[model samples]
Target: MNIDVGILANARNECRKLLTEQVGVLGVVISSVDGFDVASAVTRDLEPAKIAAMASSIAAIGIVVSQEASLGASKSITVNTEDGFVYITNIELAGQLCALNVIANSSAILAQIIYHSGEIKRRLEVS
Candidate 1:
């Protein structure tokens, strides 16, 4: 059930396709909890590795906040901004936690994308 580099690589490609087709997303990245890029689809102007690292940092903060507030477990976290939004969710595969990020404008679409990504994670874990 442990996800290896090859699986992660495949997952990244799937994520990119899902983002582009399903969510009308511009940038998408699947990162490790420690802030390493597992997969990404981004423009040439962006740096995937750096984005992954930053997203991991942000996810860590969200986890801490959720823990401290007694919010219990958080399946996903979203941040909205003037330009777009950032969604980060925990991809629990075989007891291992990875992070998936989607950048988009529509909140509803982003939510659906996150949900779908979670499903993907579950499938990966189970299969």
Candidate 2:
């Protein structure tokens, strides 16, 4: 992704909102499809770089899985673990494709998390 500074700033700012305003959001990562961390806000000693790469891989697999199942183009992938949940979706920043990864605490409402994930994608998009 050809990440522009303006787009990066917007992403960073949105990530901050996820951390400060949104409850149950443990981390937010916006990474290039090639596995580069473009912008992120993480807590509790979470590593953004590692998650960024994994998100890219996960998204790639999602795309393949969707194609194999004839499910059309995949937009996102969600993972729920025993302790928490991870949401990974594709976001376009200034026409560049990137992954928007959100981690939520176990106590988080699943519906709320999904709703805010859409909001984050809408906010981070550059026209």
Candidate 3:
């Protein structure tokens, strides 16, 4: 199925909005399940393509692990480091698979970020 450019633009705006509204957010990306970059809002230092590819792999791993454990489908995967957090979540809207990825500083609140991220994922789903 073909994705609408207008929808993609709106989704990218939503990503930018997430970055602006959230605290400590360094970047945000929306990528397809097959590692294609859909839309992204990132800083100069971050490479959107690379982030999308890595996030796709991470999301795939989450899905696999969930299936192996019989835990049903994975909703999100988060990686916390000493200085940053990487959030990768599956965007499932009418079975059109996509991934939402965000990078935030260590100071960011995980609960808030995850909560808002879920909302962003849902918004993207409609597009």
Best by lDDT: 2
Model 1 C-alpha lDDT per residue in residues 24-93, reported as the tens digit of each score? 5667787888988877887566677888999999989988898999999867888887767787888754
Clashing pairs in 3: none
Worst 10 residues of 2 by lDDT: 118-127
Tens digits of per-residue lDDT for model 3, 9-123: 8878988998888888989998888888888998778888999889989998888999999999898898999998998888753457888899999878888988998887766
Which candidate number has the best TM-score? Answer: 2
By lDDT, rank the candidates, best first. 2, 3, 1
| TM-score per model over all chains | 0.81, 0.93, 0.91
Give all candidates' CA lDDT scores: 0.75, 0.87, 0.84
Candidate 1 ranges with C-alpha deviation above 4 Å? 1-5, 93-95, 106-108
Each candidate's clash count: 0, 0, 0
Q: How does candidate 3 fare on TM-score?
A: 0.91
